[model samples]
Target: KIKRMKNLPMAALDSETVTVVKRKVKTKKKKVKTERKKRKSKENTSLKGKSEPKDKKIQVLQKNENNSENVESMKIGNGHDIEEKVNEGKRSKEFESGHDFEVELPNKKQKSSFRKGNDVEKSGEVSTGTVLKKKKKKKNKNAEQNSELENIAQKKIVGIKDKMNAKIIQATLNTKYKEEKLKTALKKSWSSNGYPLKIDTCDEDSGIKLMKRLPPLYYAPIFFNFYNLIDSPSKRISMFYFIYLFQFKQTTDLKNASTPSLSALRNFLYGPFRKYLMNITGIELDNTVDMGSSLYEQTDVLLCHDDELEGRRIAYILYLVPPWDEKDGGTLDVFHTDKNGQPADIAKSFFPVWNSFAFFEVSPVSFHQVSEVLAKKKRLSINGWYHGSPVNRPPKFVELPRPVKSPCHIEQEDLYSWINHVYLDPWTQKEIKTKFQKDSQIELEQFLAEDKYEALLEAIKLKDLKWHYEGPANKRHYEVTKANKAGELVRECLKFLRSEAVFLIFSQLTGLRLHKLAPPDSEDEEEKSSEKEPSPCVSQEIRRVSHGSYTLVHDDDPVGSQYALDAMLFLGVSEKWTQALGGFTSYIARDEDEELLTVLPRSNSLSMVYRDKETLKFTKHVNTSVKDLLEEEQQFYEVNCTYYE
Candidate 1:
């Protein structure tokens, strides 16, 4: 019976299908009729209180309502078109909910209905429910994706806004701290003192407290190994000058790292702090700034200098050292200028104090130096220059007149008494002349008589000799002892070097015309007139060199620019004197940094050189080791003389 039912033809089951359809239609009709009667009775009650509609309008409304019912009933009776009936029922529901027209469904909903309609015969009710659910799910997914994209865009905008706000705040803070924020006390002190005021940065009004809080800065060792001919123990080293045992490190711009604190500090110094400096110093400065951190350990030193450079208005040093005293030997010594622009003496000395600041206008008279670091503590600080208008410098200082000498007669017996016997030999003189001509220099060891050398070494210990301290500090620093102030033996030695007999000997040794009476081939009146112009003369000094003594090559010195023959006889030199102890004489080319010759101190030795106008010379700064000899009352002496041709 089951197989017969499954195999039944479409027409054979038509009667049963029709009966079921009729029953469902009858149930729907009853519900619809009941709802319609309620709506009609409500309408009649509402109209009872108002005028009746026109007869033509009433007839048209009734006709439309009847037609809608008839079409729904026809759709329900067709079992094969049951999907159409469901659609019409949905339309009726929309009208009941107060819609006046047939509502348009989404394309997706219409497509799903079409697909489900084709499957209705096989799956019936399940397909219809599934299509509606899928349509709703697709609509919700689209909404969710759109919402997420908007959120992402909003977040990006917020991130950009936050970055901009941070930048604005930083700019405001920088602008808030201006030149007006500086303390009045600082400006008043600067005005009163004129220069070199010691500032205590620990005070809140100092306006540089941020520098103290920054992390430790880095430093590199700044030791320049060569003995400088011009400037020594300088904070800066040039092609020719070196800083001997300087033992300090410096940054060129204080930009060693990129840490946040370091960057902030750099910005503060280059920006707001620069304005404060301009206000306090009352100097117009540009935006250019040169800043650096420095570290000075034990034995470090900075020699005397005027801090003069182009466009540098103010020089400043901020001390970040530990507890210090004058005994510690890092005191800042400010020199007083003589009537000339030369540095004369320390007008004032300031010891390094923790968190103290010092500043001065950079000018010709602003000579200063950092004393050697004696204690084991580190001397840390920040030092730099504020650049602006060029300094209106004073005229270059004219040095005191140097003594001049003409060749004078001296007996051969007087020369033999002091000079070594070997130097007097004609054969040795010929050999020296040959070598000096080839190299322009020569050093004669044991050039003095053995007995005379010993006597002069002993006589140099005499305390009665009047010693004149020689300095402008920037050009030369040493002690000069005149021949009249020296003992009998020392006086005789000084006289012999300047005598005509020694001048003739020097001419023979160096092949120079130092002792020549007339020019070579002087037969013409022009040559005779040249002789009357000026005779080749000699300048001599008995120099006593010890610690803190040096000579730099300067353009203002006329003698260094001339062609001359030089002779130096070193006496009373320590046996332990080495090149490292400094005090050596160096000769270099004027236009270049080439070293021509270097003569270290050797007791009883004579150094002679003939140089052209293109060469210059300087004495190496005697290092602190020379101070040790002072305790034993020992001194290093030189009979230094220059013979011009």
Candidate 2:
């Protein structure tokens, strides 16, 4: 019964539990048998294809072995270990294909692979994350640098564009001014033909008859009295002169006519006469508003000098109307030589106050334009030039006698200086008159004996001369006649002689009207040369005569010696001439082991001599090498020789 109970215990086990155990036992037995069968099959297969399978297995094993070896041997680095492993894999592949590969991997790939290891965590190698971070940082730095460079390039481009725009604006302004000037000039030319006057009166006899019929003057001399009435201290008479003349009952009335009040004349002149003249002249006179000083009210008048004149004298009258505002448009523009020897802008303005007259030599070179009026006041002045009379009459007055003790003497001096410096020096005036005369040639002897000429030659030899004439070839040879007058002849002459050593030497040596060469101070502040301003360690007046033509007027104050040297350098004048002038010789050493002798010509009476350095003997002539002279005058050579040669 006990045996039966044990068997029952075994039989009474749960069905689920009994089935699980049986299945496990069967699965284990089957697995064991399958493994045995597989091993047996594998052995048989290997036996059938032993050589091929063995080789493949050996290759695979070798590749795995090599990969493992590379991984182990690789140093922990960023991408370096990975690169080694990848290269090992490639080599294994080439080996399996039975092909020799000499492939070159790119530098970046090599570096990346060399940084990463197989077991990135265990090797403590650089992970892809860390490598990406480094790359990103480098990229960010490069981008910043590129951005900065781009900004700089953009700024430079913008600055250039701005400059271009400014130049365009200036050009536009200049063009506008030119157009206005041309229109006014044409109108004046037409009006001067007496287009509005009766045709019969155009004849000289008729004009003279009309003038003779006018009333006789009593307050002053017949001729000078008329001027007094017009020039009355009263602004009313000055302003209403035309109206009074028209309203006068008889010729004798002018003699007893009392001058009008100044205020009344000023008002009339400002309101009606100014407008009338402007309308007739077609010159939109305006005052300069930005003038820094109150000494003068600026007025502008524009004119054009065309080639159509053909050397004939043309007469026209100008009426000045002052501005209401003292600072308004009042500049008088004059044509002068530019840096390139072309006509340049030289303008001046007169005060809008009473009794101001500006008269200048009339020619093609005499370009005058009025400034804009700022004060809205009327300027009153009569404008006329003396026209030569027919042969039967007395000599015609070319210029009005200058008023003495004039209130505007300062202005006059400035204007005179400018005129003398730029255009009509005594020499220039003589030159012009002689040249305009028939068959007139410059006589060198005419000026040689003058004390001024002698002094000038002495100054030039000492490098102290500030001004000299620059004239064209054949200027001295040609007899210029009024019949063959040309406007630009003088200017052309100056341009030709700018770099002529022979001309400069002759002028200095002969002492002929050399004072005419001085560069004039600009009457108009705005027309002042750029080189006239003070600069550090350099105080000199640099007047550009024409383009590429310049003159340095050094202040003969403290550094006269230095300025003399500088003048020699600038004019490229010969030291031989200096040596020929006796007793006032000074030695100047140059860098090229050369010496120059500075001489003053007028030391001895009327003879060329040289003072010897070693022996104090005055020789008849000195040997000053031309080369040394040229070197000493390097600036002049550069400016004149380089351009002309």
Candidate 3:
């Protein structure tokens, strides 16, 4: 029934469809009008004259659309362009909705119904907010970094400044203490009356003071025995006797006397209190040249020619007082030029403490004497001279009608050659025998073999080897070591030996012409040598038979003396032998005795010899044990040689 009805109502259905179509059309028209009105309202509200010109606003809108399209194109999401369009439409709707009423323009010549002030203020407020936010962020970041750095710097600065302040305080305190101590010491030294001479009494008469007199120059003369001066116990006597005569000239008329009894003067001069004189006075007066027929008597004084004047022209005296004994009275007396250039006296006293020095000038009138020794113990001191310059005149030899034959030259050349040849060819039996032979042929052969053959021959003719030592122990081992290692380690082990050897050689060579080299007194002899042992002087005399005196002979050529020639040859041979022998080795035994361990060439075997400490005698090893020697002595030679090389 429904199907038949549907077919029959075609006309009616057509009429209804038409009516519906008309209504739809009308609604669509209404919607379009509404949309247009909304768009217009939005445009009127948003496009105010203050925002921008109409054309510029349109351009900006178009630019915004293009930028949105570009942003959508860059997006990866599906339907991104559709979503962006929807968002833009929504934004446009929202903008339109926000405009409650449509803005009106008064006329073409009047401005649009929009205020520039509110729009500009709103934009400016937004920009200013953004700028302030950025500035705040940057300032926070900079402030944080700066605060951190400042904290670290402050921590370091505190420690550094504290340390600097502490150091400054310590330095100030130390300086203050040092200055105070120095001032105190200076004050004490200045106030002490330890010096021997009193400045106030310098002008007193020289005769009134026993210390000023040359005969009894020492104070408390009664305490000293006068008999010991004439009898000297030492082997070497100094040439200070001449100075003594001059010093005593004011007290006695010995120079004018027909025959000066120097022996009597010597006897008178001896006294135990002389040490006190040395302490208070600088004078070291002694009758050294008064020996009968002594060479010094014949030799003319070179520096001072005047007979009347005596005493050291310039001298230094060292007074050493022991710290434990203040009453020992060690003082130094000095002669100096006064303000008017006349001789003036000055004195300084020293306590035997370490690092004490007393210095004063020396002159002719600076005569001074030491006080008598009150203590039983001896006082130690050193005295010497300083000349204006080197003496211009040559040393004057003893005057004689003809030059006396020096007994030393002949013995020196023979002994030197023999020792040199033995040392050079220690293993050569033939050479040794030839050198030792008594015949002139053997002696001539040895002389010819020497480096200074002419000199050796002349030395043999003159006999100038009085002071030579022949024993093997007398050889200087240290000297040999030094010469061996002279290249790189110049100041090594060899240096010590060289220094000691020089000192010993000088002691032996510088004849007893100086006060320091004076002959020993009886007390000194007793102190130095044992009662059982023979005197060193007697032994020296016996040795003189083999090695004669070193006096110059008339037969010797003036060009170069035979003695000098022999010395040169001996020195050369010694040096050569030392090098060839690989230096010398010395050992100190367990018994406090010294020994020599000679190394054999090519064989590498050590030959041992025992040396007597007192006499320095060498003997073939017998009961001596090598194990007993000090380790240093045993190894020093080998180690020193290797290190030096």
Top candidate, metric TM-score: 1
Query: Which model, 1 or 3, shows the larger TM-score?
Result: 1
How does each model score on lDDT? 0.59, 0.26, 0.24
* Model 3: per-residue Cα lDDT over 447-540, one tens digit each: 2234434342233323332223321111111112222323323222123222322222222222111122333335755465333332111000
Clashes of each: 0, 71, 20
Q: Is candidate 2 or candidate 3 better by lDDT?
A: 2
Cα lDDT of model 1 by residue, 129-157, tens digit:
11123223223423443344334434543
User: Candidate 2, TM-score vs. the true structure?
Assistant: 0.18
Q: How many backbone clashes can be found in candidate 2?
A: 71
Q: Lowest-lDDT window of 10 residues in candidate 3?
A: 1-10
TM-score of 1: 0.62
How would the candidate models be sorted by lDDT, starting from the highest? 1, 2, 3
TM-score of each: 0.62, 0.18, 0.17
Question: TM-score ranking from best to worst?
Answer: 1, 2, 3
